[model samples]
Target: MPWYAPRHLEEALALLAERPGLIPIAGGTDVMVDGNAGAAGREYLSLAGVANLRGVSETPLGLAIGALTTMTEIGRHPLVCRHLPALAASARVTGAVAIQNRATLGGNIMNASPAADNPPVLLAYGASVVLMSAMGSRHVPYAQFHSGYKETIRRPTEILGEVIVPFPPDHAHHYFRKVGTRRAQAISKVGLAAVLAGRPGSWECVRFGLASVAATPILACALAAAITGSDHSVPRDEELAEALGRDIAARDDIRSTADYRRRVAINLVREALAPWRSQGGFDASH
Candidate 1:
């Protein structure tokens, strides 16, 4: 198996164009695992030498996170922590310290696992992925990027460049929760990310994202709308929980049953929403 390590984006694209089957390797975390199991075979195109595809930078619109940025970098980035705490939280929960240091954001997305932590947070943040190919470049919304399990919109000749997370003004509150066999180094049975804006007096806007409960990481618009329109002061906790459970289409899996996951998701949402209620309204600082 041959490996090509190009130093520039254009050179990398040229190599990809020349060999369409060349798998792009960033952190090599997932690739090594799959390769060991004879899943990805031996040939690969290493992105390590691609200087352009690393680091997290601030853009005029928001933030541009390069594909090679490690999970550890995302977890520790002050901008990420301040702007998208849910993303930071998710990054912190991905594997352990050693894995976090080597697992790249692009690898996580390209893996397309239902339990991948970053997708839900990205969906909640309304992020978009920048993909480049010999043909050109295009942006795909995070919600639309994943087609199904182990599948994405990326083409054979394309590589994920960066993730663009738009800035949100006004008061914003984010909540993230995950359930698994144990706390550390465990794959999620279910995970959720929620973002709410506006004062508690009025639920102006809301976004909900979830993983391991659907075909792909999803934005629960119906659930968000339902919560936003309802009376904030009403003590209908059980009803709200029930509503969220109904909106999620969880299915049975080896890790757990669909009913259990749905119930847990409902409880998690209720707990996540509790903070806003306690403040008498949403706090801008929180």
Candidate 2:
């Protein structure tokens, strides 16, 4: 595919609308792989010169992270680290350092990979994507953005603008763990993001989202809701694992068996909530 760098998003959007075979390329980390394999005779809109689609800031709603914000920046941002620690942790482990330097949060989300680390974290944080077109702009929750494996609801003419994540409550804690073939530079076999709040005797919020264990990354809403109001602190790991095994719709893939992913998802849930067993509340440091 031939490449053209658009100076502005409007130009890119216009090109996308006019050119039936145009592909948008930001980091090109994921796109190029397909393009290199003879998915050609098309044009690519490079967003490197689009200045507006970059940066991270605190917004009235929460944090507004620009579509082009790199994983490296996301991992190191003090604001991100302090508030959305799971996201920060996810970004840090998202690839090797070099890929992190080039990978954008928007690209990561737009890729819509089942194993993509950002989605689990962002979904757990209740994040939304700001999508803009020549017509107008709209916000879509991360959970709803992905419709299927490697597929998103984004139209070709619409550009992903930014990500909005509401700040979790001060009492909230987060955990992100990925099971892969290697420690780094390997795709996730099973990834989990868990967030919890409140003290031992009372439970306020309990959310768990897992990647590479379903058709699309999922927030175990039904199960989370089931345990949200309970006073029980030491999680019933076995029962929870059984529930996960029964509830999660997983399939055997090259990474692992569906049964294995199901097992890991349950264990991740248990481990993430294990901190509550101690004297204080959950801890993110672990």
Candidate with best lDDT:
1
lDDT (Cα atoms) of all candidates against the true structure: 0.83, 0.82
Alpha-carbon deviation at 179 in model 1, angstroms = 1.5
Model 2 TM-score is 0.92
Q: Residue 19 CA error for candidate 2 (Å)?
A: 2.5
Q: For model 2, what is the error of residue 56's alpha carbon versus the real structure, in angstroms, after optimal superposition?
A: 0.5
Model 2 per-residue lDDT tens digits across residues 1-286: 4877888888877777787466777887888677353364767778868978998899999999999999999999999999999999999998899899999998998888888998898888888999987778999988799898888999888889999999887768788999899998889989999888776566656778889988888877866755653455554676576556654788898888988887777778867877766644653433
Q: Where's the lowest-lDDT run of ten residues in candidate 2? A: 277-286
Best by TM-score: 2
Per-residue error (Å), model 2, residue 99 = 0.8
The TM-score values for the models, in the order shown, are 0.91, 0.92
Model 1 over residues 1-286: C-alpha lDDT tens digits? 5678889999999989988888888887787777353354556889988988988888996889999999999999999888888888999999999999999998898888888898988888889999998889999888899887788989999999999998755577788988999999998999999887765447655778888998787787767766766665634777666667656778998888898888888777777777767775565655
Q: In candidate 1, where is summed lDDT lowest over 10 consecutive residues?
A: 34-43
